[model samples]
Target: MKQKNKKNASLAKLTQQLLAIDDSLTGCMRCGLCQAVCPVYGVTLKEADVSRGKIALLENMAYEMLKDADGLSERLDRCLLCGSCQTNCPSGVNTIEIFLHARQLLAEYKGLSGVKKIIFRFILPHPKLMSFFVAVAGRLQRFFRRKANKNMGMFEFPLLRPFAGKRHFQPLAAKTFSAKYGKINTSAAKSGIKIAFFPGCVPDKLFVRVAEASLKVFEKHDVGVFMPDTMVCCGIPNLVSGDYTSFKRLVKINLDLLSQAEFDYLVSPCATCVSSIKENWFRFRKDFTDGERLQIEKIHDKTVDITEFLVDVLNVDFTQSANAGCTRRVTYHDSCHLKKTLGIFAQPRKILKNLSGLEFVEMPEADRCCGSGGSFTLTQHALANKIGQRKRNNAVSVKPDIVAAACPACMLQLMDMLSQNGDNVEVKHVVELYAEQLTVNS
Candidate 1:
């Protein structure tokens, strides 16, 4: 009887803590406006899939008897963390912050899953181990990788087919961006802006060319480059998985590494990485040491998407040259982080619209989530594909020869959707498209 009372007391304590963490949700007002914007809710139509529904569940879990912890965690994980609900909320509820809070709280209560623990704890924090694994994976990729779509650059891992499902992905690169470039320290001859390059996970491993193109653009515009060696993965994957311990450790690693150097801005080809550094770093600021918090603030202020850098920082003249006569219809896909979070809409569009031989067409629902919420795509692929197919149809409806996005992750999803549908459209990073024009003009 005493032991039972002690257990109940502990459970009550945990529930109270969870409720305190989720108190930001009190602003929600049970508004159903989120249903119109939530990608998963649009597909599932389950009240449990939308933000209000999840908020109500969280409220219940905090106050009511403890029931299905696993079910609650799964419901929280159903979201893409895409910020659509927050963006659309008339009452201005911070749904992203609330959802992240719910995820962390529930994951703490239910405990991290086994597979996620290994990846988040052992694999992610060590850059050396991740690089070593990337090297080994790259070397062995050709053996397991079979071409699934040629133009789309997707492969099927037959050996890991059971784990990979029908999700076609670009094979790991033969060499990482760091391997090719090492660490570069170059001064601007004219542009005068110095940027520390963060070639995020996808660019570092799967799309080295995107990193290369970003470098090329910096050089062409006479912008300085700082490619630091000590960089690690941004903590988005860990944060999304609700593994705050790993997330904080990775943040410290990155903050320490970046503090060693000085630059005007930290530039990344990956919009998601920039968003994580800019917004999420601040969101989780309370968890850092005092000195680390200052560094996070300094670095956060300086992070910018590559598209924004080219047009805004370089002050690239976009008057549309007289000989800018040649044409191909290019539609731009707005990365949710870049668009909704940062309000970086016109800069990328201006970069695309200014391309000498390109005609920029706005795809319907251009700002829709590409369904690649980082790990969300890997875990919930069928639902992701369903959302991605909508994005794909919108891009193809414009009959664009090229679909451009500022995010590599979005590029991957767009490729999969377009390839699976046998569409002739090619998806590319907006920076890559801009880089192509720079090279031709040069």
Candidate 2:
């Protein structure tokens, strides 16, 4: 009986923390505008699947009218955290912030699972250990995976299908980007700009070519780089999972590493990483010490997407004469975070347009969510595929030889969708396309 009272008291405390965001919750007019843009709600069409419905649930939960915390957690989990609904919201309610805060509170109320606890707490914070595991997995992957599509570089793991689902994914790289180039520190040359390059987990571990291509572009333009050997996951996965303890640890690890580098700007090929550093890191500023908060603020101000850096900062002249003989049609997919979160749709397209051998074609609904909302793809694979198919169809309709994105996560999703449909279209990062032009011109 005493234990029961203690548990109730704990629940009450969590509920109060959730209620603290009442201003943001009450800002929702319940107009259902989010349904139009929400990818999950678009597929499920369930009121509980959209932001307004979720907001209503949160409101009810705060008022003690909705007692099913498990049900509320499940409903919240359905979200992609794509920022689509928040972007399109009429009331300007901070939906993502509210949902994330609510998730954090709920996760505190009901502790994280064992598997999640292991991955988030134990593995992610240690870059060396994560790399070691990935390296081992890379060596043994052939035993488990069979080629699904040669054209898209996708594989099927029949044995792991029950756990990983019927999906074709890219194989782990033989060597990670960090393994290939342990650490890089170059002096700024002709461009007179130096950037701390953050090749995020997917790019570092899986799409190593994207990271390499970014380096090529940097070298060609003489933009010096400062990539420490210490970078880890950007903590979006942890934070979005409502594991603040792990999130803070990862952030601090990165903060300490980044603070040691001297650079004019911090750049990354991964849009999600850029968004997380630029926007998401500031959300928990109060949790850090005064000095750490200042570092966070400085880092936040300096972080820029690679495309944004190339086009806006470096001001690369894409106006050079186009190679009329070599025209490979390329369409751009605006990553949700790159566009909706960072307003970075135009920069990538501008870079794509300027690439000498590529003809930039705009696909239908170029800014639609690819449904690869970090861990959202893992938890809700079927729903993610449904949302991704729309994006795939739009790209196919444009009939481009290649589809370019500014995000590694989006590239993974695009590769899966294009490969699953047996489409031969190549998926490349915007920087990869730019780097190809740089190679050709040289």
Candidate 3:
């Protein structure tokens, strides 16, 4: 590999790597169809705002039309990388890969912020230290947060306003799931299949009860579960931020933890974790040694989103008579990782449909990005909130008693959006609903 030129990195080389985007880009045909589906482009009509425009920009970079590396990076980071454009693209260009690689290159050049370096590098790697901080944060949340909007779950932190901005957020959990439930080994139920559960950081830390609900569901099905005492972050947060090195470390840690276990499938309530393990690991697995690579492939092969596992793997059935006088109308929001990345839009809905007393209503644009792109929300909050408002509107339009999603990060975002909007819609994990349906007698 040539030394990456601090001043004049070859745009041609960068473009060549980008163009080799798994033939997904080959299908794009420079179609402008993505422009209609892009939320950022919807907000900004700049040619660089749409996927076609960005693809053109990258192509121009290959031919040397776009210079100013910083400017190009800014344009690249503008994307939510929601895969909305790829899903909508007539050519089916792998815009997600292009933007992610582009961001990595730019971050390598421009360098990450000191805060990011500290957070991703130091904190995220060590779940124990991270849990401690979250514990304190949860205890002190009331002192720091002032009601920003009564209905939207919006809160303002006067001290951290400069960094966090005026937006609402859920308070961190006092105890992370990993801390509370160190390791679990449950016997298979009548189904006679075992799975290892990976709840990722957000669900484990912020929404601990969701993980509990998952355990409950597994017990109900008589499905066994294996959870290692120590699991690392899922690495999507590190990967998307252009820190492949840290991402690799996290992947290795997770693989090492679960590699010693015996389970039929690796499961997660988090769509991002399932996709990251199933997809991104393979995409970057080449960097590892043969031994590690084999382990990576094995995990990837076994990985399944929780809903997919419930509906597909265990053959859980959701079609049943609705509970008489069931009053709660629940709606499902498809996390982009589940719907777009893994093509798992229906199974979650199917699981939601099974809840006896719950009315499963479909929201408009049920598959749109909720703008909780992990660190994307933290860094580009204004843009994130703008995208989230659209999601909030769709959910609100349905007037759901509660909102359900496969990803905890999406639940966090939905909770904030609904809270800020002053709507009282509770955000619940799909597994939680399934757990509730388990016949205690069975």
The C-alpha TM-scores of every prediction are 0.94, 0.95, 0.90
Mind giving the per-residue lDDT tens digits that candidate 2 earns over 1-442? 9999999998787757865866578888788888899889889889989988888777766553247767777778999888998898878988899989988887886788899999999999888898999999999999998999998779988987665567789999998999889989999998889999999999999999999999999998898999988698999999998899899999999989888878999999999999998988988988998989999999998999999998899988887845454578999999989999999888888877776778888999999898888777877888888999999999999899999999999999999999999989899998888887777779
Tens digits of lDDT, candidate 1, 274-313: 9999999988898899999988888888888988887777
Q: Which one is best on lDDT?
A: 2
**Higher-lDDT candidate among 1 and 3?**
1
Model with the higher TM-score, candidate 2 or 3: 2
Between 1 and 3, whose TM-score is larger? 1
C-alpha local distance difference test of each model: 0.84, 0.88, 0.79
Off by over 4 Å in 3: 1-28, 60-67, 148-155, 439-442
Worst 10 residues of 3 by lDDT: 58-67
lDDT of 3 by residue, 204-278 (tens): 877887899888887777888999867878888888888877888888888788877788889898888888889
Candidate number achieving the greatest TM-score relative to the actual structure = 2
Please report the TM-score between candidate 3 and the true structure.
Answer: 0.90
